[model samples]
Target: MDSVREQLQIFVRRFGLLNATCCEACCGEDVSLVQSHILFEIRRMGEPSMQQVAEELGIDVTTFSRQVKAMEGDGLVTRRPSERDRRVSLLGLTDEGRRVLVRIDRYMAEKIGQIFSVMTPFEREVTTRSLALFNEALAKVGEAASDGKNIACCN
Candidate 1:
């Protein structure tokens, strides 16, 4: 059997997480994979603050701000001062940005459907459950590490 690291590396590459130019069929001609994710998160979260989206994506505030500025220039995103907190900047997508996001979503859903079509129902069920478990396990590990405890779990 392949080592877990080897399998995960292959999975990540296949999922295009490491691709610089990941989305092109979705108006990603000018956007990098990271930028695409930022746009996606902004749209998904419905006008979150600049800091909120940056933290969700695990990007540094400075770098995220730069990317947001670039996207704003491209007319894909807009930032306005928060009414509740004047010091905060709330982010939103333009009409074109929403269209691009929809294209990206449709493309991704089609790809997932193609892959799921080949899997047996049982296999699909197990795979979905396993991925959810994996995410939960990773979140626990992350929380432990953030709290300055490095407890190892082997299962």
Candidate 2:
């Protein structure tokens, strides 16, 4: 049997999670995978602060800022000072961004549907539940590591 890390690595590769640009064909834009994630988060959070989105995505502020800047240049995102706090920059999606996000969503939905089509109904349910459980466990581990808890090293 493959080790857990090996299985995860294979999954990631198969899903194209590490690709540089993933949505050009589907969305008709040169959006990187990271930018797509940022767009999704911004749309989901509804004008979240730059820092808030960064923390949610587990990305450092500096790198996130650069990505956001590039996105803003592309007219896919807008950053404006919060009315209540001038220091805080809130993010929003442009119309173009929204369209692109919709395309990406459709593409992903189709891709996931195709993957799940091969499974039995019971298998699909189990896989969905297992993924949720795995994500919850991953979040807990992330929180513990962020809180300075020592995690065992493979080495």
Q: Using TM-score as the measure, which candidate wins?
A: 2
TM-scores of the candidates in the order shown = 0.87, 0.90
**Per-residue alpha-carbon lDDT of model 1 for 42-128, expressed as tens digits?**
978999999999877777799999999998998889999999999999999999778777878888898888889999999999999
Name the candidate that leads on lDDT. Answer: 2
lDDT of each: 0.83, 0.88
Error of 1 at 102 (Å): 0.5
Off by over 4 Å in 1: 25-28, 147-155
RMSD of 1: 4.0
